[model samples]
Target: MFICPYCARNFYRAPKFRAVSHIRFLNASPNSPAIDVYLNDRLMFRNLLYKYFSDYVTIPSGTYHIKVFPSGNTVNPLIDKSLFIPPEKIFTLAAINEYPNMDLLSIEDVRHPKIPDKAFIRFGHLSPEAPTLNVVLPNGNTLFSNVSYKQITPYIPVDPGTYTIEARSSSSDERILYVPNIRLRGDRFYTIYAVGNLSKPPELQVLIPLDGNSYIGS
Candidate 1:
């Protein structure tokens, strides 16, 4: 068991965990309760979240491709099976629903370098029925002021580099949404679409190949 240095809480395992797939689902209403869960065409758990209306599945340690679909919703399933991974250690999966009041959408210009000659940023969300978009640069500066939106925006732009974007209710008191660890690169454009809610937090994914090769970063 390990204890959190900050929270002083004991954990059965350390933070350096491995391949165990954790799956979660929320708001299991009649239309979507105990939905069917799958890991790469294999049925691992069924109605996993039916009784408590919330479900979680822990798969054996390894890498896996995951797929999620509603019971008998073959015509129009909710989640498509994608990549699911379980490292050599243990990890917990927590699934929750989106706060209907807000949805977050943002993307950076992918083709251009981190900083382009001309940049355009795009952000979108659904909630507070029309709120202002607030963008803060890594330098602790404001690029765009409180710009109100008519509908969910498609995108916006900044000078370049890293930044944080948030949605504030018209009054700027309540935070509607937040997007962090957003790194704008000169290579490709990044776009995010949050439906109902985000399946997972925005991730800074790094793909490393198994082939024996050394990577030297700047």
Candidate 2:
């Protein structure tokens, strides 16, 4: 904090802060083998298995080319996507669909919260072969309705606690996936991602993960 001698004016370089974005990867392709994720040809996630999420990583904000492949192989990549990352955003890039027919689904996670005492959660439907669904409680109370494949709902605020959540077919009201003991802490954000097939092995399941905005600092 020094004033210029000649001009008698205060002039201090505040600081140089590079803009950045936070990102993580989620493997939701039930039939796919453990995978590798690349950003601009550089490996970001290695051997990420189904329903698993990588820890968040920070990067300079800009456009990036993303590719996903079976672990240890770069040839014949499974996915190729072009994405633009704005500064200070948090995201999860989910690898979805069965093997040999997969795509990347980018999910924007929560940022700052307007409510401090409430927890927030969203439903992300990633099952390629499932029907339009309703996110509900065990007692037939619906939270998100008519969500189809690759559809992600907006954040819903609720009391901070562990609870049972369900996914049911929107038409028949029959239960599809039962998620138990999902714990939501106050001031945090979460996404309950429904993945896999409704009629086959790797049967329907949900992966609930805390969003990066809950802890990652800008």
Give the per-residue lDDT of model 1 (tens digit) for 1-218: 10101111222322345433333322212113455555567765455442121223344555455444555444344454444343432221212233221111212112222334433444323222334655454454654445554232334444556556554444554655565655554422333322222223322111111110010111
Best by TM-score: 2
- For model 2, the stretches where C-alpha displacement exceeds 4 angstroms are 1-17
Per-residue C-alpha lDDT of model 2 across residues 86-153, encoded as one tens digit per residue: 88788889888888888888888867654878998888999888999998887767889999899999
lDDT measured at residue 172 in model 1 versus the true structure, 0 to 100: 58
The TM-score, computed over Cα atoms with residue i paired to residue i, of candidate 2 is 0.88
Candidates in order, TM-scores: namely 0.32, 0.88
lDDT of 2: 0.80
Q: After superposition on all CA atoms, what RMSD does each candidate show versus the true structure?
A: 13.5, 11.3
Which stretches of model 1 miss by more than 4 angstroms?
A: 1-119, 127-150, 192-218
Q: What TM-score should be assigned to candidate 1?
A: 0.32
Residue 61, model 2: lDDT of 81
Lowest summed-lDDT stretch of 10 residues in model 2? 1-10
